[model samples]
Target: MGTAQAAQAAQTTQTAQTAQAAQTTQSAQAPQTANAADPGMEQAPIAYVGGMPPVMDHMIYSHALLDEFEARADGHGGQFRYDGQAWFGTDYDKLWLKSEGTVGTDGRFGDGDHEALYDHAISRYFDVQSGVRVDLDNGPTRAWGAVGVEGLALYFFQLEATTYFSDRGAAARLQGSYDLLLTNRLILQPQVEMNVYSTNDRARGNGRGLSDIDTGLRLRYEWHRKIAPYLGVTYTSSFDQAASMARTRGRQVHALTVTAGLRLWF
Candidate 1:
């Protein structure tokens, strides 16, 4: 072909190519541009409401069990151990404010012992607990203090340590527990508690300042919608300064307790 003819043909081809490119671009973006009004959804922008209703539920129960044992020196003195517990909770957002406490009576029908467990959850599975207990000792009042993190991995395991202070002296205990689910209605909880006492308290002959070994198995069966019957057998013994006091007051005493109680929740 002639130079002028070839130039004309090339220009025509270029024009056709440009038109095709423009059409392809428009086709590719048409659906998106048209759907801008609907945004491919029929719902409006939803903002999570900032408020949730507070949950209020509380339970009160009493347990009547035989509390009898033989001390090395005291020997064959039996008393009934009665315990009562109650809890109240208020939840806001993700925080739960709770106050729970227990009161127990000795066999002699004297002033009962009491302890309160304070718990606040900053987030799911992370909570702080403060515990204080007062005993019926004739002298200065007995109290306990504790602060720890719970649920490091999951809700099945917990670690906590407590320091006890009283007119007599001071002591500390570190405890860890793991809950194993055996069935829908049954669970096994294994716990380890280590006790330590200050020199002054140990010297004063405080029973709890010495070392203690407690290993136990606890099982619960739900009998009603809000109540469960629980049983536990624990092997408990004391050592060191506490053990020495027990021996002088009374051998290393070994005893086992079989506890049957009702656990109720609302």
Candidate 2:
């Protein structure tokens, strides 16, 4: 099993799959919390769905010098997010992981459909992560970010922590992705991701008590080169009892967003 100690589960690594199940797993297991304006920014929408559970054994290793810009709707509020991630791997299992950070600006309406950002604000933050995969007789399994000592793919759990100006907390993510290869060059992937918030903005009496879920699916044709690109659709949803309360208290939200984008690796 290969697990990185300092990788953020939010970062993605472009890995080709060999089948539909793997494609579906890759799409279903990614984080989608950021954007709607840019095609490259919008990935799987599951990152904002709030209460969905993390998928198992999914990991994305990002380049150390890459950045992404994204825009999306948060419930009724529109926001833009930007992220950058870098990766490192060890010889042990060829295990690779990445670190990521993000910043967001809001442009959504206020409580009464008034001017956008009337009472809302923009913020910036960063997170740390790590992940690993395991090979088993029954199946290939893994864990990312703070993987505990249980289950068949004991090393596939993903971990993340965010520290913002007004809110600071940590979350544990579980996800897995596999692929279906079509002639060794064509493939389909599915992914699932679950996010559990260990802390929320408890100060100033604001914040949802918990976190959300994110998932994705994608298909691609690989040329067996140093760089590859692919296209796919994504879905997102959220769940948190505390978030409900925060909504009731007049917070900004969008609830859902569907997007398309390309995936690349070198």
lDDT of 2 by residue, 1-266 (tens): 23552243323332223465687876765544224455787577666455777643244333442222334444454443222333433211123333322223433321110000001112112122223321111222222224321112324332233222212434444545556676677777665545555454332222343355445555666675333345554445545654564567565322454333334444
Candidate 2 versus truth, CA RMSD in Å, comes to 30.5
Off by over 4 Å in 2: 1-86, 93-97, 100-170, 202-210, 245-256
Which ten residues in a row are the worst by lDDT in model 1? 65-74
lDDT of each: 0.53, 0.38
Number of the predicted model whose TM-score against the real structure is largest: 1
Candidate 1 TM-score, C-alpha based? 0.53
**Which runs in model 1 stand beyond 4 Å of their true positions?**
1-106, 109-113, 116-118, 130-132, 137-140, 144-146, 149-155, 164-169, 200-210
lDDT of 1 by residue, 126-215 (tens): 656666666543334445554444444456576655566655457676666676778777766665656676653433234544566655
Cα deviation of 150, candidate 1, in Å: 4.5
User: For each candidate, what TM-score against the reference?
Assistant: 0.53, 0.40
